[model samples]
Each structure stands twice: as C-alpha cells, then as structure tokens.
Target: MHKKVLNRDRASFFVITLPALLLYSFFYIYSVVLGFYYSMTDWDGLSRKFNFVWLENYGKILKNKAFFNSVTVTFRYAILMVVFTIVIGVLLAVALNSVKRFKTFFKSVFFFPAMISSVAVALIWDQVFIRALPNLAPLFGVANIASPLGNKQLALYAVLFVNLWQSLAMPTVIFIAGMQSIPDELYESAVIDGASMFDQFRFVTLPYLVPTITVNAILTLKGGITSFDYAKALTGGGPARSTMLIGIKIYIDAFGDTPKFSIANTESVLLFLVIALLSIVQLTISSRSGVNKA
Candidate 1:
C-alpha cells in the first residue's frame, strides 16, 4: 500500500509539471540553442547561403568600438541604477515600516511607477523632458532647457534616472519584508539597552537585510544591462548613440542599417553570460554569508 501511494504521488507531480516543462523547452531552451548556433555563422538574417566562422564574430566584437561604447554605457547605467534603487528602496521601506500613518497610500504611490508599461512610461517622460521642461524653463529664468536625451554628456544619466525611478518597487517590497521578519524582541531588547535606532539598524537590520539586498541587486543589475524598450522609445540611441544599451545595440544590428542576425545573436549570448555570471557570484556570496545572521 505504501509503495503504491508513493508511485501515485510521483505520477501526479509529473502530470502537474509536464506542461510547464514542455513550454520551457519549446520557448527558452530552444531559442537559446538557436542563438548559439547562429552566433558562429555569418548569417545576415537573409540570403540562401552562409558559412560558419566559429568564433570569428566573437573576436570581431572585441574590436568593435560601438560595441565597447555600448558596454561602457550599460555599466554606468546599471551601477547607478543599482546603487540609487537600493538606497531609495531601503529608505522608503524603513520609513514606512516605522510609521503607522498612510502606509498603504505611500506604498501604492511608490509601486505604481513599477506597474506602468515601460513603453508608456518612456512616452510620458519623453514629453516631460523634451516639451514640458523647455516650456517651463523660461518661467524658471532658464535660458536653454535642452532635452536630457539629446545631450551626449547627460543622456546616459537621464536613462539611469528614469529607470531607477521605475525599478524601486520590488526592492522596497523585499526590504519591508526583511525588516519585519526580525523578531520584535530583538528591537525591544536593543531599545531597553539604550541602543539608538542607528546602532540597531547597523548591527541588526543591515545584517538581516544582506540576503534581500543580494537578491535585489542581482535582479536590478540584470534589468539594467538588458534594458531596451526605454532606450528605443526615448533616446533611440541618439545624441551620438550615447545611451545605447547592449540589448538596444543587438536590436539595431539585427534590424536597422545592416541586418546581421549572427552578430545580434552573438551580442545576446554575451549579455546572457554576463547576467548568469553575476547571478552565480551573488548566490555564492549570499550562501557564504548565511541568510539569518551577519
């Protein structure tokens, strides 16, 4: 009877998961395999014939100045986004957790930006930066209110600012949960011992938050590295192509000017490796640090 029950349970689990497994194989797994295959070929996404050049395309990417520039821009954007989002999210979470008034209202207000569609957000901000800002500049005694997206020096920072604004919701949620999970006894004990709020946060809160921080950091970094929709809709890689992310570069290579499918696939593969590497490193550090204690 026990053996029969175990067999039936295994069969039920497989039945429940089979559809999802099949979909994963058909979509992500298959697409990743195709990307690798094309990256080695000289396929321009057209023509009847092309030869595989193994790693020649990968080597060319190293020598490509535009590719290098895109990488630099992505790093700048991701670093700033991760830093600002984590700081802002943590502050909001802590403040909300400590207060009893209008908590839900503030939470909803912060998270609402994250819920908006990226393209729609881009369009809304484009108007604010390009049209409204210039018009308002005169009233503020400003002579020239140039569009942020049109300035080569400031275009990357503009994208970073907007993206940071949109990406704070998840981290804020995670942080509140992390803070709340600490036993009330710990905080009470610290208070009785005459420890100030800053001391408690430094010694207790931050240590408990390490895992949450790691999770938010890794996810936000990946989002910044592969950002595309906003770049396409807002800057269109303009102002001397200053704000082009790796994902946008991949799109341009595959669809604009010269359509080189293989080159785009190569860029995609590189982006995948970067995200994967960071995830592994973060998980490793998190595990070594232990989730519960400092």
Candidate 2:
C-alpha cells in the first residue's frame, strides 16, 4: 500500500511539472546543447552540409582585437553601471527612508523609468544625446560641447550614463526594501548609545544591507555585460565600433551577413563562460562577506 502511494505521489509530481519542464528543455536546454555542437562546425546557419572546423573559430576569437575591445567595453559599462547604481540607489534609499511627505510619489518618480520599455528608454536617450544636447549646449554655458554620442572618445561613456539613469531606480527600490526589513530596534539602540548617524549607518545598516548589495551588484554586472538594446538603439555601436559590446559584436557576427555560425557560436560560448565565471566569483565574494559579517 505504501509503495503504491509513493508511486502515485511521484507520478502526480511528474504530471504537474511535465509541461513546463518540456518547454524549458525544448527552448533553452536543447538550444544550448545544439549551439555547442554547431560551434565546432563551419555552417552558415541554414546549410545542411558544412565542414567541422574544430578549434579555428575559438582561435580566431582569441586573436581578434575587435573581440578584446568588445570585452573591454562590456566590463567598462558593467563597472560604471554597478558603481553608479549602487551609490545613487543607496543614497536615495537612505534619504527616502527618512522622509515624511510624498514618499510614495517620490519613490514612483524615481522608479518610473524602470517601468518604461528599455527600447523606448534607449530611443529617448538617443534623441537627447544626438539632437537635444546639441541644441541646448549654449544654455549650459559651453557651446563647444557637442553631442557626446558623436564623439568617439565620449560615446561609450555617454551610453553608460544613460543606462545608469534608466537602471538606478530598481536598485533604489531594492535597497529601500532591504532597509525597511532591518529591525527598528537596532537603530534605536545605536541612537541610545550616542552613535553618530554615519557611525550607525556604517555599523548597523551596512552589514545588514550587504546581501541586497551583492544581489544588485551581480544583476547590474550581468545586465551591463549582456546589454543589447541600449547599444543597439542608441549608437548602433558606431563611431568605429567604439560602443560595441560583446553582445552586439556577436549579433553582427552571427547574422550581419552570410551567418558565420561557427564563429558566432564560439563567441556565444565565450560570452557565456565570461558571465558564468564572473557570477561565480561574485557569489564567492558575497558568501565570504556574509560569513565575515556574521
């Protein structure tokens, strides 16, 4: 009787999960596995017959200067986005936590951008960078400051700034949520002990907020590195590929012409490895920090 009951439970579990599992396997896992196989073969994405090119595609990526530049751009965007988002988000969260009036209004105002479509956000920022800035330069006191997007020297940073502006709100909300979750007594106890505001923040607030910070940092880093829409819609990785992230480069390589499937697959593999390694490192660091804090 017990054996029959156990079998029934197992069957029920499988029946309930089967559809979602099938979808996941077909769409995600299957594609990933097929991609790895295709990475070894030099096939135009549609071709039925193509030569297997072993490690040549991977070698080309390793030797490609453009690939290195893309990697650099990815890291640059990720670092800037993570730093600015965390700093600004934490500051705003702290300020908002202390506010008494129009708190929800202010929170919604800051978070409004996050609710907008990324492509829409990118297009709006593109216009501001390409058209509005040029027209408004005189009002800002420097008529010589051209659209930063047009200048190769400033284009990538310009994209980074716009990305930061759109993204900071989510982190701010997360930080605020994390802050609110902290026990009120901790702050009260610190105040009673005559701890200065900064001291209380450093000792009491920061240690507790570290987990949220870790999660946000990892998310920002991954999103930055894999960023496609903003770079695509804003600059199209223009001014001699100055703003080209790895994601864009991979797209260009894959479908820009007769699809270089093997090369693109190699790039995809490399991109996945880079992101996976960084995520692992971040998790390790977060774990260590949590342990130390405890």
Candidate 3:
C-alpha cells in the first residue's frame, strides 16, 4: 500500500510539472532550433521567399569590419566593467560591513540605483553629460564640451561609466552579504594574533567570501556583455559605430532598416557561444580557487 502511495505521489509531481516543461521546450528550445535553421537562410526578416544560403551569412559577418569593431568594443566594455565592478563592489561592501550606524540606510541608498529603470538612468546621465558639465565649465575655466555620447572618441567610455554606476549596487550588496556571513570569531582571532585590519581582510574575509565573489563575478560578467538598453538609449551606437557593441550590432542587424535575418541569427549564435565559453572558463577558475582555498 505504501509503495503504491509513493508511486502515485511521484506520478502527480510529474503531471504537475508537465505543463511548464512543455512550455519551456516549445518556447525556448524550439526557438533555438528555428533560429539555427534561419541562420543558414537568406531571409530579409519579413519575407516568405527566403531560401537557405549555406554559410554566406556567417562569412559576411566574419568579413564585416564594423562587426569586428563591435566585437572588440564589446570585449573591452565587458572586461573593464567586470574589473571595476568587482573592485569597487568589494570596497563598498567592506565599508558598509564595517559601519555600525545606519548601515541599512546606506545599503538602501547605494542599492537605489539598481532599482531604477535603465532608460531613466541613461536619460539622466545623458542630460548630466550634456548640460551639467557645461554649466560648470566657466567656473572651472574650461570650455563647454558636448555630451560624450555625441563625441565619437568618448562615447563608448561614457556608456561604460554609466553602466558601471548602474551595476555596482547588486555586487555591493552581494559582497556585503558575504562579509556578514563570516563569523566574528574569525576576525577576533586575527586581531588577537596581532593581525592588522587589512591582513584580516586579505586572509580571513576574502577566503570566506569566495563563493559570493564567484556568484557576483559571473553575474557582472554576463550583464556587461549583454548590456543593450543603456547603449540603445544613451548613444544608440552612434558616431560612426564607435560606440557599437555586439548586442547593439545584433539589434541593428535584426531589427534596423535593411535587416539581415540570416546574419543576425549568425551573430546571435556566435554571441551565445562566446558568452557560454567565457562563463564556463570563469566557473572553472572560480571552482579551482575555491578548492585551493579549502
């Protein structure tokens, strides 16, 4: 009787999960398969006369200078964002963790940016970069500079600055949580051993925070690579594609005038593979470090 009841429960669980499984398979898995199929076609995104082109789109993308430039810009953006986010996040987390008064208030203040819409943040930064600096230029004895987004040389860095500011909060919170999880006894023991605060952090806090660090690093890396809204709203990958990223390039190819469906799909496939490979590498490094620390 117990065995029958167990089997019934298992059957019910499977039945309950069936709909969600079906939905995921249909929407996500099916789309990926279709996208792969489309990548080999010469579709113009909205036509029925599409036919398979067999690697032409892939060749075109690989040969396109603008596409290669976008890839380089995307790589640079992701690397810098990841480095700064991790460093500043760890610093802010340490500061917040060490603070005794109104810690929650500070955390809320720091995290408020993360809650704001990306478009809103971009618009606000756009105005600041365009107007606020010029208004203060005379006082600083400098000429009014156009918004960085309007300057080809500065646009990408401008976007990077805004992206970093918007992204810092989540990693900050994660690091703080990691630091808080470390037992006070560890620090106390370090102090008794005549260890300085920095030493304590280096030896005790960092080791304890490895798992959280890993999580935040991976999240930030992916977010930086996949960032599109800020690029779209702030610069629109403007100034002769100087600020173009892989995400924006993909968007333009897939949806802009003269849409190239096949090339867009190829770009999407390449992007997925790049991100997946990088993520795997990061996880491997993190896991190895975790084992060494253990």
Q: lDDT of all predictions, in order shown?
A: 0.87, 0.87, 0.87
Model 2 TM: 0.93
lDDT of candidate 1 over 1-294, digit per residue (tens): 999999999999999999999999989999999999999999998768989999999999989999999999888888888898788888888998887888889889888998999888888888899888888877889897988898898888887777767778889999999898888898889899998999988877888888888888888888888888888888988779798888889998998767999999998999899889988987887777734545
lDDT of 1: 0.87
Residue 26, candidate 1: Cα error in Å is 1.1
Question: In angstroms, how far off is 238's CA in candidate 3?
Answer: 2.2
Model 2 lDDT tens row, 203-254: 8889888999999999999999899888888889987888998889989888
- Least accurate stretch of 10 residues (summed lDDT) in model 3? 285-294
RMSD of each: 1.6, 1.9, 1.7
Candidate 3 residue-wise lDDT, 72-163, digit = tens: 88888888888888888999999998889998899898998889988899999988988797798788788875678888888888998998
Worst 10 residues of 1 by lDDT: 285-294
Backbone-clash count (model 1): 0
